[model samples]
Target: MSSSLRNRLAAVVMAVAAGLLGCTPASEPGASSEPAKPHRVLNTTAQPEDTIRVRGDHTERLQAFLRLRYGDKAALDAPWKDAWEDTEVEALRPVTRRVCARDTATADGQEQTLLAVCQTLDDAATVEPGRVDLYVLRVGTDEEKTNRGGFFAQLPADDPLLVMAQRLQGQYGRHGSPGTVQIAQLGPQRRAFQISHEEHRRGHRRVWRSYIAEHNHRLRDVARYRDHLDNLALHGCDGNPADCGEGVFAVDFNTTVGDSNAVEGYWPLTVRASGHDCTGPATAFYHLIFDARQRAYPVPDDLQRDGCADS
Candidate 1:
């Protein structure tokens, strides 16, 4: 029931299969190098004067979009200069040709949203017929600080990978799954498949580099979120109105998104607490994000300190 227990459980449940929960790539056959039209404005932050161009290769589209968002100073990760935002895509099977993103950073620093999109072009592919069209990645953040900190992506709620990881993670927590679960039990959560999806993919430098990056992200996210779980417990209903149940904390996931080529965004968890006899729960957002090197822990919401004194 404690936050520490919950975090340990979550860490055990999730191997941090990050991209697994992120949006996927869709391949095109004989498709032109020109970018496709907007499948739908997944989400945007550009002012009315901004020009959103969704044509050309994914690299060009992302660069153009960033320049539009951050002005001419826009520059991408060094390794990804030749591709879509430093994304490593295999060239066979669901061979990805490009990745792109459109984000907003209003001068006022209002809430911002980053939409990282990907496109795959393959000669022969039927795994997901017609799934090759552009669609927002399932995990993302639309927060102002998240955007300014360069950690936002358009990860949707229903991504298959996200669902799988959450299901595995949900088994954790006091009322959820057991705390002793192992990563291997989660079914080879790594991106590389047991079967050889691409013969030449193993040789690509980008592929291996991306995998290393992904592994690092996983380690960082698990440790960070686990720490969040441990710390949130300290603020439980410590000296609250007696009628409320003891330490009754209810929580739900806000989201997980790809922020940039380097660090991923593990958005805050929407949480609230109250006792059994209490009329309502005190709500707040708890974020435990992992920057390229470290995890930023969650702090108190406005009401956390005043109301839940005992917590």
Candidate 2:
């Protein structure tokens, strides 16, 4: 072999050796080559993650769970901010503590889900791995189903926790929150959702109770704007005679990461409101910032403001 070729081969072998050695931390003091992984890591091989491709809403809710802080962890402190609509979320685990599956009946038919009780653990974990519970939700598809209506919930008798997660996911994801109560009258919350029954299902009533315990989160923001700019005066017909009503706030559904097939997917929520008094225009946009260890979806109070100057 030529000396030049031998030198090139030696360089390639050295590069491979360096990469292999860098897989773990160095014995000497220097930054480790390992990258920072986010909290809510999913799909462990020791205890495999669920394979169920749940209804769109459930998937979205799961994503909402993934983004929030798990506690006062310095590492996981991330909040939603301005004009980040195209922000891409890593497909991190939804902090699932426990997952249970069950069946429920409706006028239209029956539906099933793996009621995963989720929590935020550091990339390492907050609790002992043995202490954490486990269940696998292996989902089935249309082609595999021999019968119609897909999969139906067939959990162990009286496993109320699974039942409850099924109920809440169905109710909230189905009807949404209280201010905008969903009428039970709406059939199947719109359209068809099917599940497979071939898999043996189990329920842990404890999981449902835990899910409910952390589910009640509220977001509130107090913004009082007074613009005496001739037209933008507070409740004043003097500055701008033709005054519109109070600024309108509406919830905007984030389509990204939501189930592409379903219209409304999950609750990584955003609030949009536009206000003006003729001098110009102002808007407040809010998205629930997930803190560590949140269970239920919280309407966000943190509002990012956008305004057009009168000057």
Candidate 3:
């Protein structure tokens, strides 16, 4: 077997073992306030004494990328220390998914490899749980140039994707439940990314925001909707306890994205809900059409809100 394959298999095994052993870091009472002592950080660059060097492998590159990004944060030291490079904590490690790879002709008409990668940082504790980041790597023949330009370059401040991410971060506080990143193919040559944020209050709620890829590697907001909502509090059961079961109302919608046959330069989102309420079992379907001028898929006003109202 190839060395790369073996390394990947070993990483999978280690992640599984770590999960089984429950080595995830816990939020200490005072760990966030105090700065942790300096420790050896993973070295991605080639050095005389370094044992392993990160080259083109995405997994290795992601590990090195995260260590360089968050290794120095004093607040994250405790949980970061237990991550893959330092110790064993699956939740604290970086999770990566390859979006796509394409060979395109450059200005000089030479074929260049472009790769899109999505990485989620599940800090477990300290702060920013399930924070996701996207990267576009331009692979070249020169290792030094590729590493310097692709791995270390930061996303521009005005980038649409970064802006949307920041908005979500502000909407959901640091201690909010971990969010998830997903990729969907809208058409043969078109693709989009969906960011889902879940929160729990008296009830549970999940919202999905979709962005479509455009020219110059930018993303445009396409759709936003609530896919899950549940209210655990019983209502409309004042007289008798038997009706309490029917008083509970919860809604879950399954969303699917596909190429839009009706609209040009857009995609269609289908939301199907199979839920129950005091009224009885309820089912509904929403075919959200994209508004080109508005550049968004308008969801029903009722579905846009969270939680079930007491009737």
Candidate 4:
């Protein structure tokens, strides 16, 4: 082979060897030989946790708790303030603040208190027309601990009950409404949290969704259903409000915790709804019997369907 051809062949062989060994060609003077680091895409999703910081002061500890619970998605600045404090934080106001306690015996037979703190996020601008976020913290007394407390369970913004309610809202083509969170005593040592979303648009429409959840090590959804719906627009009141007449269709639910059977733990929920639609007046009764296999009260198809006829 010719000298020039042999030299080109040798260069090609060296390049192939370098490519096989994952070696890059030398760069110009002062240029970096190190490959550029990949840009890291951070996971901003909030992770619900059952443990939090319990050492700092009330405010500091709350701040730490929010940070730990929300991670990168936590807005620690303006418009988002802690509603747990006694006084209002600037424009933000406390919508719901519930504290429930239960007595239980520890491993050593010492009586311990289980405290549940439930609060809802408040927005100053849209105070009464938006779906508010809820935060729940289950704290236990620990005399030996420095802070004298330890969190046992927590239900953050990503709670299943809240997600289900939001999904219902989406299905109804409704947005921006107010909701409430309350603690319910189901039995002796059993406590459950109930979340209710209510929306009323004067003569146009009205809707309500409710959910009950209990925490046993982790949060479990017990009952969820659309409690009420009153839509006047579906019949003939869409164009003219005054011509609505008596052509309104509405559904109202009356729920009872336990039945006449007097069952013990996790009492059954019975829901009864009565209303009149375009067709005629109707009444529906549903016994939210707990199924041990599914661990959730399955809502009936008729109950889940919209109670209004097509316009």
Q: What is the lDDT of residue 226 in candidate 1?
A: 14
lDDT of 3 by residue, 1-311 (tens): 34553575689888898899989646787567675533332222211111123464534443454444345431211232223232443122443222322222232232222322322334434344443333333333334323644422332211111111111121221342335455555544444555566654444334455453443444556666676655553343333323457556666678877655745445687888776643556587888886766666778865544325424
lDDT of 3 at 66: 40
Per-residue CA lDDT of model 1 for 1-311, tens digit only, reads: 33543565577556455456774445578768886432222122222112232445445555665454334544544211112221223221222322233333321232222332232323333222111111111222245223534222232322111101100011112211111211111012222110001111111100000011123323212331211111122334334433335443322222233333323333233333322221244344444333434443233444233222223
Candidate 3's displacement at residue 263, Å, is: 4.6
Off by over 4 Å in 4: 1-50, 56-136, 140-178, 198-206, 235-247, 259-264, 305-311
Q: How many backbone clashes does candidate 2 have?
A: 12
lDDT (Cα, tens digit) per residue for candidate 4, span 1-311:
23543565689899999999999787788998786432211111233333342554434444555455433333333233233222333232433322322222232243322322323334324323433333434333332222423222231211111111111111111232245455665544455556566554544354455444444344566677776666664554443323356656666778877734423355677788787544566587888766666766677867754535222
Name the candidate, 3 or 4, with the larger lDDT value.
4
Q: After superposition, which runs of candidate 1 have C-alpha atoms over 4 Å from their true positions? A: 1-222, 226-280, 295-311
Supply the global lDDT for candidate 3: 0.45
**Minimal lDDT window, size 10, model 2:** 200-209
